[model samples]
Target: MTSGLVSPKRPRNLAERLVGEFTREIRQARLRPGDRLPTEAQVVRRFGVSRTVVREALSQLQAAGLVETRHGIGTFVTMNRRDSGLRADAAEIATVVDLLAMLEMRIGVESEAAAIAARRRTDEHLERMRAALDEFERLLGAGETTEPADFRFHSTIAAATGNRYFASFMGSLGTKAIPRAHLKLPDLPSLHHRDYLASVNREHEDIFNAIAREDADGARAAMRTHIGNGRERLKLRQESSDNLEPRRKK
Candidate 1:
């Protein structure tokens, strides 16, 4: 009999059954470190599936960091290597998918940072925040890109929070594209009839007001509300686009 890795009577999709077989073999130590898996063809034969299905199964194992495939060779079990490639671009790609992943993170971090900065920002830090905010306003009004200024504003808040790590992570994100502008009440001719930006304005003002009043909790709450509002707007925009446009010419 084969390894009998799984009960032949298992109830699941073929891909799932393959995962189970691979996992069982791994757990039973039948598949050891550096063990090269049989070729995709062998898997096709064993699993009674096409090459495509075998590839999908191996892909799942690869995602789990349990196996790796060499271009010219075959798939092999990973002894100890961590899964670095699976989510390497998740943070970046999430922007396109969710439109709010970054803002959600900001709400969690910057909102609390706003609270801390309200209580702890030094004179210099306050000056920097003011400067950054001013630049943000200028760029936004000048019809120029405000992405950099927006980052500066958040970075200043992180600095004022008096936590170096906070600032560090915020800066780390700076290297990634910020989705704030995309989520902005876009300059859609359709949406321009009403004051869609009013909510956005209020949210920013609330955050600024909290900072001005040196109210910690208010700043945090305001920031969260602002981010949450943006997320909602993004959803609305996506929903509106669902059937609004005619099919594009191929």
Candidate 2:
């Protein structure tokens, strides 16, 4: 039997890494509902990580409804495991409504993030965002998935907010914040896919420019427009898929 829990290479964010492993175990049924996870010490030792990492991972699991922690007791898998953490839930967000709702959340959270990043970002933050963007474009040129670079771009903005909470929230969402990472429908034609990705890169460039110029309002507006446009594209694609379904029956 295959275990979905893979040890993260170069685990920079131990908490999120642990979250993925434990989430994988739960979703794979290796850690079933009502099963108490290993003690914090055991988890640290077993994973060769820290207690803080274990606790943070458990906290995120509780937030995601995958686990529950009882005082002086232990953390147990909850019956409400609707997802295998955030990233894996990408495959499950198949409907336009779900995609739109996720975008709505992003608009509220990331618009402010971008605005703050514009006002507060340092040279280092700007450099990181630029690097991520460059890598995203290069990966696209190679026809590779741009999810990691795309996510890093957004996370850098969140980090630039100078608020750990913003960064942590983005980290918890993982790659699910990237609309293209989820919203799986029928594939766009090759030309359309290339154009779509290019448009997304252009949007990223707009955000980068606004932040670089220290235009807070411009940054916020750009982020909103980017997310809103992505939502509209998903809606159109979903409608197209629905339309094709009726024709396929005929």
In terms of TM-score, the best-performing candidate is 2
Q: What does candidate 2's lDDT look like per residue over 1-250, in tens digits?
A: 1111212233335566787898889878999989999999999888898664565566556545667666579889976545432232333434446557878888888899899999999998898789878988997899877766777788779878877556666656665566555434566798889889989999999999999999999999999999989888866776666432211111
Pairs with steric clashes in candidate 2? none
Q: How well does candidate 1 score on lDDT at residue 206?
A: 75
Model 2 CA deviation exceeding 4 Å by range: 1-19, 22-95, 243-250
Q: What C-alpha lDDT does candidate 2 achieve relative to the native structure?
A: 0.73
Segments in model 1 whose C-alpha atoms lie over 4 Å from true places: 1-91, 175-177, 180-187, 190-202, 243-250
| TM per prediction | 0.53, 0.62
Count clashing residue pairs in model 2: 0
Q: Quote the lDDT for 151 in model 2.
A: 76
| Clash statistics: count for each candidate | 0, 0
User: Which digits, one per residue and each the tens of the lDDT, describe model 1 over residues 157-227?
Assistant: 77677665565465334423244433333247634622444445546667766787799989998888877
